[model samples]
Target: MHTHHQLIAEKSVIDTIVLSLPFILIITIYLTAVFISNKKYQRWPFYRIIFFIVGILCTAAALIGPIAESAHTNFQAHMVMHLLLGMLGPLLISLSAPMTLVLRNLSIKHARMLSKLLKSAYVQFICHPITAAILNIGGLWVLYTTDLFSMMHSSILVYTVVHLHIILAGYVFTISMIYIDPTPHRTSFYLRACILVIAMAGHNILSKWIYANPPAGVGKADAELGGMMMYYAGDAIDLVIVVILCYQFFKGNSYWTKKAHSLS
Candidate 1:
């Protein structure tokens, strides 16, 4: 289903260095902040350092890797990028506990300011499960299904905006599922699980749609491979989140049960 022309087009590089630069800067900045947070507050742990590094790599790869850059040329490629930035990046960063580290590093006043920012209406709205679901999966449906995919390469500004959305959406989605920082609005396991199911369905359906209809310049076969990648990768990352949420729930429940039994 993929003509040689289409396959080649899917592999073109508009400017790899242009794209790679900002992501590298971001990774550098976050890593530096992680170090500063540790030195300032003595909160550095080995596992967390690894997580921060991995999260940086995931985002950097999505923006700079040849495969990823090629994917940007066609609808399917962009979808693949979304999975890396919007799903994998956030999940890894969330696990690293960036929010907690930031809190630890700040003075009481500054930490209080951060808490207030977190509780701001914008944060509240973005981190809400439904809103995060919309930003994560809903964003894909918008890009691949319409003329937006074609528009991506035409404007550098548009390209930058879309990529930022992917990263931010991922953070929102991840923070909603776990408690790394404090959340003013928390959901029950049943509620979060229900939302996850719907989110996964959105992803699967979009992948299948791409398989059926490759966007401009994307071959059907490549679309299938990309779509399958999106489908499988999403499920795998989400499974990790589900395991974490369930583990936390059980851990909390067990602690409360022990305390109750002791009192009784």
Candidate 2:
């Protein structure tokens, strides 16, 4: 039995490394691209590179290490992974302006092709604040409210799909809320703000629900602790998004106001 347990542990370690390899390669490729871009154009901000690295590291830490291993058995650790993967990681990556960097590095023809892709109707619809909010908050609702959470633990493919959805939904929601990257289908500020508020409320309410009605197979105490972590940590990250949005809104207004005064 001890030998069997040791083999299981070793296999888990191997699986973790195997799962993490793709993400590590992605980060390496991104950093290499950024480095090449900086060399080509001295104007690439060093801070953006730092943000990208930090964002990738946050994602890696959540998905590839002890935290990820614990998350399978510990609700609190799962909440931490959710925050890192779904909120902080997405926000930091958005701030990195990766699309902008890619556009800068691409040839004009390729850049135009990318721009055209961004303008596609499907991209436009999904990038809408309302749609993004639904996918982001609504996804969490489905996962926790249904048997999906428990189901995910039983299937590695489902688990990967869910995590991928979390990251992608979070990224789309973050970009919709804030104009960090080139948004060909930009929604009005008021509309985006309204969606953001509704999404945040939904997220918080779900946390509270989980507190009272724990997910399948989760202990009440563990659920409560996880719920609290999700609530507080999510708010902390969302606050950053709120601040950036408000700053951009006010700064744009201020700039236009100054222009009006000058014209008068």
Candidate 3:
């Protein structure tokens, strides 16, 4: 017979697997599509596959493991989850170039339809750097400032919604700021850089505010640690974005300069 502790551990493992099933399924589908596309066409970059796997793992770590379980009672744990789910996970996923893969996989008709939808006013508006920054940073402000943080722990539905919003908002913000894939709505590099700086400031300011005024139920010590994590960890991730944006901008400019010289 299994020992009591062993049985409880097995049950916990089963529960975690059940909770993570949807994410696993989504990852599986994405890999399947990539595999099919690569077999039919040119090979996909190995780096993209690594990025997608790491991104999904980061999300899974935040959502289904000890970190997630501890987050309900520990403010620090929750903040770590926020960093993983909102910043690092999105950055990696966006870098994976999922949209490019999807476009490549689709038939011409479907690709054209998708292209049209991408250029639609609604998509254009939401994908704008300004709009994306507002939703991403604004959502964080609301969650940390209001009682939403405390409430999320109590309601599964609310928790799920908030997590989904964080991931999507982060993805939108990253993609808007950095051209990982073809963007129907393009803003100048300077404009996106300015917006990115402002968003970073907003995020850091909110972390400091949290440090001073802990959320409804969070303790001062835990809040301070969480705040530090948010400020530093967030900056680390944002730094990668900045570097990538600058690299792409300079590279594109150089390419055009060469073309212009050749024409001359």
Evaluated with TM-score, which candidate comes out highest? 3
> What is candidate 3's lDDT per residue for 138-244, written digit by digit as tens?
99999999989888988999999999999999999999999988898899999999999999999999999999999998999999999999999999999999999
- In lDDT terms, which candidate is top? 3
Tens digits of per-residue lDDT, candidate 1, 9-55, equal 66554356566677678667767777787666665777876787788
User: Sorted on TM-score, highest at the top, how do the candidates line up?
Assistant: 3, 2, 1
Query: What is the C-alpha RMSD, rounded to one decimal, of candidate 2?
Result: 2.1
| Model 1 per-residue lDDT at 104 | 73
User: How would you encode candidate 2's per-residue C-alpha lDDT over 88-203 as one tens digit per residue?
Assistant: 99999999999998897899999999999999999999999999999999999999999999999999999999999999999999999999889989988899889888998999
Question: What TM-score, to 2 decimals, does candidate 2 have?
Answer: 0.93
Query: lDDT rank, highest first?
Result: 3, 2, 1
TM-scores of the models, in the given order?
0.85, 0.93, 0.96
For model 2 the local lDDT of residue 96 reads 93
| Cα lDDT computed for each candidate against the true fold | 0.80, 0.93, 0.94
Give model 3's TM-score versus the native structure. Answer: 0.96
- Give the CA lDDT, 0 to 100, for residue 151 in model 1: 83
Off by over 4 Å in 2: 1-16
Q: Which stretches of candidate 1 lie over 4 Å from their true place?
A: 1-43, 73-79
